[model samples]
Target: MAAAMTRMLQLLLITTLIHVARGKVRVQITNMIGYKDDMNITCQSSDDDLGQHVLSYGQSMEWKFKPNFSKTTLFHCNARWCDVMRRIDFGAYEYMKDHYGCGSDCRWMFTIDGVYAYDSKTDSWDFRFSWYS
Candidate 1:
């Protein structure tokens, strides 16, 4: 009985530790990856994943992409992180009509791998589509 109790306590502690290890990350909408690139929307920490997630945006000081249509930063998390997790970017994102046609509003969709914690409401890009905060 004591052993089972100890195991339960251990599991709880480990879970708490994972959350504790997290840092405050702000997610913003833009065209570029990091801070400021060519086309950018804005930066802030809000409720859900940035847009409808039409575009999967993530910036690591390490990886880089080209042509620079628009770079956007989604969020900052632990060294090990992923957005649109189980949902594969190439695998799942392809099925949905991720890209929304644009003339001037540069609106798109994207994904985040994990749960995001925020108090504000998610941004609704359109009546039917919404962006993760």
Candidate 2:
């Protein structure tokens, strides 16, 4: 039966495409600083910075690709800067997200208080946190 043969082919095609692949991360991209763009959010797979992300906030969330900030420098972590970190600021927390989730599958988005633009080719967010501390 041609009809039966077609059904079998369709079933085979569906099964072939019904594959579940493992990924580097599984989380939502939060806009902590109101940055308007896709966030870079990183993943460390560690105890704390597990699914750590890198998001630039505000409309300025487009400065992450500047030739200046190639990496985020560790500026002493404090509980005070915890909630305040929500506010866009390039002073200290450069590329580090707020580290939202707790398990090895969570992370944070940045304020990108001083941003520039977003990258389309790749799902990466770029921006500058602030001009001053």
lDDT of 1 at 81: 17
**Residue 75 in candidate 2, Cα distance off native in Å:** 30
lDDT of every model, 2 decimals = 0.28, 0.34
Q: After superposition, how far is residue 13 of candidate 2 from its true place, in Å?
A: 6.2
The TM-score, computed over Cα atoms with residue i paired to residue i, of candidate 1 is: 0.22
What would the per-residue lDDT of candidate 2 be over residues 5-69, giving only the tens digit for each residue? 99999998676454212212223334454435434433321123433345444311211111112
Q: How close is every model to the real structure, measured as TM-score?
A: 0.22, 0.22
Top candidate, metric lDDT: 2
Alpha-carbon lDDT of model 2: 0.34
Shift of residue 18 alpha carbon in model 2, Å = 2.3
Candidate 1 Cα outliers beyond 4 Å, as residue runs: 27-120, 124-133
